[model samples]
Target: MAFERNTQETYYESIIRQGYSRRDFMKFSTYIAAYMGLETSAIGQVAKSLETTHRIPVIWEHYQECTCCSESFIRSDHPIVADIILDKISLDYTLTLMAASGHQAEAAKHATMEKYKGEYILCVEGSVPMGDDGNYCCIAGRSAKDLLIEAAEGAKAIIAWGSCACNGCVQAAYPNPTQATPIDKIIKNKPIIKVPGCPPIGEVMAGIIVHLITFDRLPELDNIGRPKAFYAKRVHDSCYRRPYYDAGLFAETFDDQNAKEGYCLYKVGCKGPMTYNSCGTIRWNNGVSFPIQSGHGCIGCSEEDFWDNGPFYERMTGLAGFGIESSADTIGKVAAGVLAGGLAAHAIAANISKRKELRDSIRTARENEKKFES
Candidate 1:
């Protein structure tokens, strides 16, 4: 099933054609607006854009990847979000989801590129292997590098879907035999948005797309080119066990009493303090639970070179700009020590006051006895 190009179709039109009512369209608009961090007043603007703006053509290309990004995307919390974005709208070419394959799939891709030149969105999901002249990954006799160059040549903007396409992921870790390279390193000319994660949350992906469609521009990005709305804070900043972290209550092991009590996982190599993502807030599996919530430490999958940063189960030391000397343990220990010292000091002061009062009472009693004798 090749997606037929309909240049005149708006997103709202596609939604209605897909059997959704106006109310459903509005609901989707509201839902996306909230996810995008838009104000209440902007809900109407988002809806208006979907109602008036023509669906932008999208060409999703996959190279050396596990296809987890696509898997996470299709399983978005809202069924309509997947339906409207992946199927009903302008997703003209995607090898994973499109029905057409081989030459038919290639043809649809080329058609959209030619028809929507400098107008279509290019979504690259995997890294390109620069080793062996790009022989590591190929599709239909074309090298991954060659495919990416051709597809990116005319794109309005490029969206690098996961860590693989953003920071080279595990493929680029260590010796990197394949020399897997992220898209931004290859295509420096185009504006690229890096949604870096092992597999980014489904709603975050949808929010990014809707943001692009609604505003006809890119969302406000962080210093590293991620959407600031979703990546503004570290996972530790929002984790439910943050109080435990601040209070020096840490789980020393995976099955310790502290772990069972829901203490902070920092001592056991939780990377939440260093990892900037919305996992704690947006969560996964339809906002049910993220990795930390499921009793595992954050691996900092979203940060650059996270795989090589350290061992997954070993705690990081001397993190800069975090707490005292950039160590959460240090902060917690110091806080605990200060509290204990204050209590001890208070106790000693009270004991001295009691002794002084006793002395004064005895002296008064002796004076009374002398007065009575006189």
Candidate 2:
């Protein structure tokens, strides 16, 4: 019943006509629900959302970026990302993958803008160069700024993909000549979800898209416009070597026994404590591995100004430690000392507590025997 959509095809009827079965649609909905951190009861909402809501047309604009966001998106562990999102979710214009290009492709994008008019979703990758009155980057003889505003005017929402689009990444670093600017700095009127990373986690990218498709709304964003569900905690909170961190064990340097034994990378400049992301859990390369798991410290790619955060190989110094939250410096020694103290205390306290219970039971038994003797 959702109108002759922008594409002139209704939501449910369009996918069916495109060769997707109802079962495929249901599976995609369920998967998206989980990715969006929805409850089991919400799958119904998710299903209805997809079934009733027309696929939001996306105008994927690329500028001063390497297109790694799209690469990571398509390589997600889940097929739904590439299959449903990239191939099916109404991506009308993209420079890298679109078969149409030159004057024809530009015309198609213009047609969608006029036809959809405040209905399509705008996804921007890379930063816009603003120096020299935005003349640094141009498309089809129009400044990037002009193109962005033109496309955004017709968009229902905007998604800023990767640090390039969110924070300008390395392009906006100090002494920038072109004055690279993030999307948020230019687009102030609409809601923007910033998924920042060198290349965002593939599944996380998929999750964001799916949340939009399944809920027709943005996911719960944190102060930074990142989804709280995925960026809620530091990677340190979930690292496997966290026990080593708490116990104060460190590798000191790479190739040491501790490093080989999978000790915490805190000593090797891991930014896990300061970085918030799903890198430790969702991982990368089809969930096969992440930097930390591969024995490298987190570079905090998801964070702002990470390029200036410090040298990636230099560990953080002078952190607070208490309540078993010690760093990698003294964990082994402290754990040994604590174990020794507990062992001595447990030995002395064990027999007396057991004997007191035994004494009470024997007294009760003796009284019962006296009663029987009488």
Candidate 3:
């Protein structure tokens, strides 16, 4: 698998050669920087990096899961993301997107791996099935495990895209017949950046790539390996209906007047409070609306083992360590108690401040009267 070494073109050069204007390129850079949670001053830095840095060679592998991650990537809000970020990169191999198949596809992947060695990025899209000696999923007459190990050997970095690759997704859910396993567990000794979601938001996917391209390093990750910029905040923290939750207003059931009024959906099984994702902010379909905005509670798809957590429509109130029995009937009572306690503490503090102010006023008046008599 020998590849001719051609001059590697920078991302900006590729875009310009493809007929995108300079303005368009910089605008795309600014958009990427914002989504990557970079400071305002970093817009120029992003543009400069894209202008000079050679496009990263990528080998995208797919295995035992749906192709929704590819679907989401293609449907990014701006066509430039697909055109510049994905297309401009030397994407040597991807089972779903590459037109070449069979021997041609296998050749391309090997060529990139051999040529780039430890410089290329390995993007894995699904989990590997190890049940029955990895018989569950095979590609080109070889098990997925064999292919993944071969591809990952010389890669500089690995990206586990979507929940399937990150946490084995639903394939490894309760009573999993295929014994699907996540990439991190299979491949040790490599730092994997996990982008966990049923199919992560398109912009979020692009943001991760742009960060890698600009910084020449992986973005900061939380304990779970998800990028901190996107997974740092819970969906509930920024949810529009958070006010309702704080005020003890909630929808008991779907299609009720409370729901129509956009009250909190905690009782009907919203997982926003427990799930960390950028859905409430970055949103899907170009920031239009997410699941909650569409009148459905969060299913916590981003979290690991979400499928086995419980029924999707059932509120999980019997959580351990909260010292409270949880049920649909008792949710309102809990919310009310929290609100009442907060109000009482505020009132007590205000009374103490008011008494101190009056005491000071009387003491000052008496001192002034004594000084005048003297």
TM-scores of all candidate predictions against the true structure = 0.84, 0.79, 0.84
lDDT of 1 at 355: 92
Q: Residue 229: error of model 1 in Å?
A: 0.9
Evaluated with lDDT, which candidate comes out highest? 1
For model 2 the local lDDT of residue 291 reads 90
Q: Over 4 Å off in model 1, which ranges? A: 1-3, 317-374
For 1-374, candidate 3 gives per-residue lDDT tens digits of 21332327898888898888999898898888899999989999999999889888889999987989988987888778887677545577888777678898888888898888999999999999999999899999999999999989999999999999999899999788999999999999777999999999888999998899899999999998999999999999989999999999999899899999999998899999999999999999989999999999999998998987766777864543344446544776889999999999999888887988878998999899989954
lDDT agreement of model 1 with the native: 0.91
Q: What would the per-residue lDDT of candidate 2 be over residues 1-374, giving only the tens digit for each residue?
A: 11222554545566676677888777866776776677889888877866777677778999889999999988887665576567554678888777678887887788778878888889999999999988988989988888998988888999999999999889887667799999999999999999888898888888887788766788899987888878888888977778999998888798899999888888889998988888877789977888988999989888887776656877744333432345445666788899999999998788676998888899999999989954
Write model 1 residue lDDT over 26-95, tens digit each, in one string: 8988988988888999999999999999988899999989999999999998878889888667688998
Each model's backbone clash number: 0, 4, 0
Q: Give the Å shift of residue 79 in candidate 3.
A: 1.2
Give, for candidate 1, the lowest lDDT window spanning 10 residues. 317-326
Residue 159's lDDT within candidate 1 is: 97
